[model samples]
Target: MVEDGASYWRRNLLIVWISQFLSLMGFSFSLPFSPFFIRDALGVSADSQVKMYAALATASSALALAVMSPLWGILADRYGRKPMLLRANFAGAIIVALMGMSPNITAFIALRMLQGLFTGTMSAAMTLMACCAPRNRQGLTLGALSAAVYSGDMTGQFIGGLLVEWYGFRQAFLYSGMAIGMSGLLVLLLVREDFQRPAPVIKTAETARNWHFKLGIVLSCLPLYILLMMSAFARSVDGSQFALFVEFLNGGVNEAGAARWTGRAAAAGCIGAMLSGLLIGRLLDYFRPSRVARTAALGAMLAMALIAIVPVHMLGMERVALDIGAFGLYFHDQAAPAVLALVPLRFMMIFFSAGLEPVMNVWLSKITPASQKGIVFGFAVTWRSIGWIFGPLAGGTISMLWGVEAIYVVGPFFFLALVPMIGWVLRKIRSRLES
Candidate 1:
């Protein structure tokens, strides 16, 4: 095992963060424009067709993340995270650039699917950071990385909105590709992988008896994924909701102002997410992990309600009040990881969280019998992905059919249900702790 206070930052971490940041910025540049490309560039005429294309695009990415995340995790474990990050960045950069040249919807979807396959770069970079960072500082380090993720996402969205409007999709895409390619090179130059000592091998029979670990992993993962479903659902609402809200308040503005301010609406979450990412880890160190997680879930519920109940009629400071409330609630989005890190072994927690996320397999590494960890984590993630696969489709369908405001009502209830579920899981975890 790597010793505490090893020179992870001087040697490994800074490089990884820098590379990942650049790559993420690149990825961000393309995100805001994806829907526009699908609808206008791809020649989709109707709202429903645009939605279908959007869903397909998202499904392709989710499918890729769902299928490949575990495989990448396994590979990172065996080989190293830096190499995987390199591959992911290089391939992802190429794929993103290719999205610019796609003449039709078919090619666009294919390129996005291919982009998804390479999307594990962030996962790998995160895994690398976890592996190398000082154990005690895992929360802080991971928090910083979370900030990077949020910042990168926001940067990309803002840039994508601007570039797509100013220079068109092709130029915006080329910019994204260049940004990603540079990140790949930076990784190759900067990140140095120090091999990890193998974890003590546990016998299969004895390992199977570690049921608390098994239960902890399952309970933790299932709820984490449900939270993810809620977030993704909210994310899907961003484009349409921002436009509608702005228009309703501003009196049916054109797409330019809508898109410009829509970028701001989405940008609102980044500040909160970034601050949450930075602070939540420290907060975790102070508070009970379960408490923090539960608070996040509850906060999300309340925020959703605020969004639902507050009409666009609210002006000036009133709108600011709604914004603040929504922002605070959005911070709770990563409660799952904070909750997960509360598990023992701080050194491994970050990797476990990063690896297990998007697929829910970290439970095996963190909580279960080494022998059965893979199987249980796999199963848990399978269930999680099933949730993810349907969440946006179901949420989007309902929002479109009934109204987007309905999501505010429905999403909160779904997220709030997890609070109690997490309590039950924590109780189960406590039982194991007592045992």
Candidate 2:
């Protein structure tokens, strides 16, 4: 049974939340401004050129994330999550700071790639939370984490924009690094890891030949890449057309007005994200996690499709239309939190599966061999990293060739593709377990 919120709010919870909240604030400060930095500060204004640069940065960083995520997961499994947490926090803090020192866009992307390699703070935090929290309350714990993370992100976005407007982009980057570094220091001092038994070693040849093993790994990794692809596609479209959308709203208004409108739309999306965190846990409890996730995907696809079909003029006048559409986007974004509720325990494994750390933990705990947890998670992150590579490239290509609406129209079909694949895998998994 799920525990009451009050009951689940324990000492460990506070520790994890506080540390994550701090780290995330630093991360949030840099996110929105990164694109702007590339576009305005660095002076890369061509649409296709910007898309290519974004893809390069995204793919490179994700590639690094892909390589390191599972390695860290495996190490944490072999040793303890506390060490991983400290490594990720302190190391990531340094990386973020260094990224601020990049002399050019080329250097910035390189530093970001390094950041991806070291950015397992979330993975480690989830591992700690999973070990500390009761099984029934996994969703709630993760939900709180999600809320804190998003709050940090929102705060960062708000402040980063102000800082950029005032002191300039470089100063904003420095400020972000300092904020994250302080949080990393706090984590080093506060977080503790409880030791666990080592994962059993598995023969690579036997696991490779085992169809069930291969199937499970494939199932765990594929959907995640697709989701990444969809998200990248969506974000790129929005990024590419943000100015156009704002101008359209302001009747082809001035640059300043367009900037303000863009900010408003982004803030609306953030608000939607916050609301999703609040409600997604309850929704997951009310339905199967898979169902909740699928529904969210459907809602997202529908919103994108509708946005493509519905005239923008209608959107501005109909407040309810904007509300519903915005809610759909928020719901889509909540897929990870909702699915994490049902993930099996090791917690980090869901990172392999695509729902971030919470769901990854749940899934990993259930299927990962007691002795081979580290290797399994490491491999999983590697496969998911492949998604990071393809997702952005596909998003960029599709948007360029077919237009933004085409990307949305095609995304739902991508989600639909997952249904049969996931169903088949689940059936195979069930049979293997029952046998």
Clash totals in order: 4, 16
Q: Cα lDDT for residue 233, model 2?
A: 37
lDDT tens readout by residue for model 1, 1-435: 233225756456676766767887898786555666766577776655655566566667666666766666555555656677888899988888989889988998888778766666656665666556554455556666766666676667666767777788778889999999999998888667666545665778766665566555556555445544443443343332333343333333232343444444444555455556666755543455666656665665666555555542233222221222464464211111211111111112122222212221121123333233333433443344445456656655664677544655666666566566656655544543333
Over 54-105, each residue of candidate 2 has an lDDT whose tens digit, in order, gives 6677678778988788778767766876777788777777777776667778
List the global CA lDDT of all models: 0.56, 0.55
In order of appearance, the predictions have TM-scores of 0.75, 0.73
Where is model 1 more than 4 Å wrong at Cα?
A: 1-5, 196-255, 314-387, 430-435
Worst 10-residue lDDT window, candidate 2? 342-351
Count clashing pairs, candidate 1: 4
After TM-score superposition, the amount by which residue 42's alpha carbon in candidate 2 deviates from its true location, in angstroms, is: 2.1
